[model samples]
Target: MAAAKSGGITAYSVKTKTKNVPMVDPVIDVKSGRYIATGKDADGNKMAAIMSKATAESHIEAGNAKKGSGWSK
Candidate 1:
């Protein structure tokens, strides 16, 4: 499968079986390490989860969504 990107960032707005079960962290960076599903809007709608290039490609291969593909300024 081919991965899609926005603004040169490959991110996935994955949804869990239930809203409660799937939660993106309200914060993105944690301890200088990448955190999974850590973006949300003021309305609490989850934003895309960033993954690393390696992780993103791996998930693309496995057909699973892995976190880590965002670059920080």
Candidate 2:
């Protein structure tokens, strides 16, 4: 595993109904052709958010995360 980036990606959390919650140890993935970022919230609960391909790629490029299986930066 790579070192996590500081102040990691922030996205809406459906579980807590919060906005701009920082995600820890985020990993980018592709699901049915859409880019998705999955990680844990401050409470340790799993959270995932759909993001643009560019956003995912940027994260991967910045060492924030590695490209998931079947995906590339």
Candidate 3:
């Protein structure tokens, strides 16, 4: 697997109330195999967290996010 270095561009999935909501989040790359995201949660309130790459991929698999750059939605 590819290792994400610090300062890389990574997106984290923000869970929604309804099923399969397509959305994107801007996250800060953490050198320790995690991402820091700042966005509104399902309740539409401010939220942030350090998430893993697997968690991010889960979001994509769950239809919450489109494929990463260079691929189609």
Candidate 4:
């Protein structure tokens, strides 16, 4: 389990049935009219979490992550 941060992005791992797995190197993407943050879990498995557009932009501009593919804003 990666160190969890307050107000940080987290993802659930279906393969491991883990909850609140911290996301590493998160990147924001717009898909189907939603903002999603994606990254890898502690086990190196891919994960994603739905987030607000404002949160996505803040994370991106804060140098915490990059805008993923299909990101229009």
lDDT, each prediction: 0.39, 0.73, 0.41, 0.75
User: TM-scores of all models?
Assistant: 0.28, 0.78, 0.35, 0.73
lDDT for model 1 comes to 0.39
lDDT of 4: 0.75
Name the better of 1 and 4 by lDDT: 4
Between candidates 1 and 2, name the one with more favorable lDDT: 2
For candidate 2, what's the RMSD?
A: 5.1
Decreasing lDDT order of the candidates: 4, 2, 3, 1
How would you order the candidates by TM-score, starting with the best? 2, 4, 3, 1
- Tens-digit lDDT string for candidate 4 (1-73): 2223564677678878988887778887788988878799878999878877777777777666778888753
Ranked by TM-score, the better of candidates 2 and 4 is: 2
**Highest lDDT model number:** 4
lDDT at residue 72 of model 3 (Cα atoms): 24
Question: Which residue ranges in model 2 land beyond 4 Å of their true spot?
Answer: 1-7
Model 2 lDDT per residue over 1-73, tens place: 1122363677777789877788877888787998878889889988877778777777778877667765743
Candidate 2: 10-residue stretch with minimal lDDT: 1-10
Clashing pairs in 3: none
TM-score of candidate 2 versus the correct structure, residues matched by position: 0.78
**How big is the positional error of residue 64 in model 3, measured in Å on the Cα after superposition?**
2.6
Looking at model 1, report the run of 10 residues with the lowest lDDT sum: 1-10
Q: Model 3 residue 37 lDDT?
A: 43
